[model samples]
Target: MRHARNNELTDRRSAASDAKAALLTAYRAAKTAAEPSRSARQAERISLVEAREARRAERERLKHEEQTRIVTLAAQKQAAIEAAEGAEIEARNSAENARISRVVEDEAARKAERDRRYAARKSRQA
Candidate 1:
């Protein structure tokens, strides 16, 4: 009887060990099955991050281009204003020179007439 009981005890221990091994195998299979889903989720996250970065880069590029265009237009406007001012100054200078020339011609004509009349009077006296 005691030997029979010892055999029964050994059978229970072996059965428990078999059950534990089966549970470990099922856990490993479940983890293996979930691996592909986890990997797919990670890939999707990486793609989303890359897309967001591309959008941000594009926005920055457009903003920089707009700023450059505005600066270029402003520079052109300033140059045009300066050119107009220079033309105005040149016109004023031309007008002043013409007025001075007319005054000089008038003075020379008066002097010539005075000299001619004095010479004629001296010839009559002689």
Candidate 2:
């Protein structure tokens, strides 16, 4: 009877140890199963952050390009206006020079004609 009772005690202890091992195994499996999902979530978060940063950088680059374009256009417009003004001034100067040249030519022609008539009259008188 004592031998049987000792066997029963040993059996209970063996069963308890088996239950503890099974619980530990289940805990490890649960943690292992959750690890992949945790890692995936972390990777997803990193990707999202990277994508957002990329978009921001692209926007900034575009904005900078736009500003540069605007400035370049403004400079070009200013240069064009200055060129137009210079051309106008040159045209006015050319017209003034032409008028002066015509006046000088007319005065010289009148003087030549008067001198020719006087020379002819002097010859006729002699």
Please give the clash total of every predicted structure, in order. Answer: 0, 0
Sequence-dependent TM-score of model 2: 0.58
Residue 5 C-alpha lDDT in model 1 = 100
lDDT tens readout by residue for model 2, 6-121: 99999999999999999999999998999999899999999999999999999999999999999999999999999999999999999999999999999999999999999999
lDDT accuracy of residue 23 in candidate 1:
99
Query: Which segments of model 2 are wrong by more than 4 Å?
Result: 1-39, 120-126
Note the residue pairs that clash in candidate 1: none
Query: Which candidate's TM-score is highest?
Result: 1
- Residue-level lDDT tens digits of model 1 in 1-126: 999999999999999999999999999999899999989999999999999999999999999999999999999999999999999999999999999998999888889889888999999999
RMSD versus native structure for model 2: 9.4
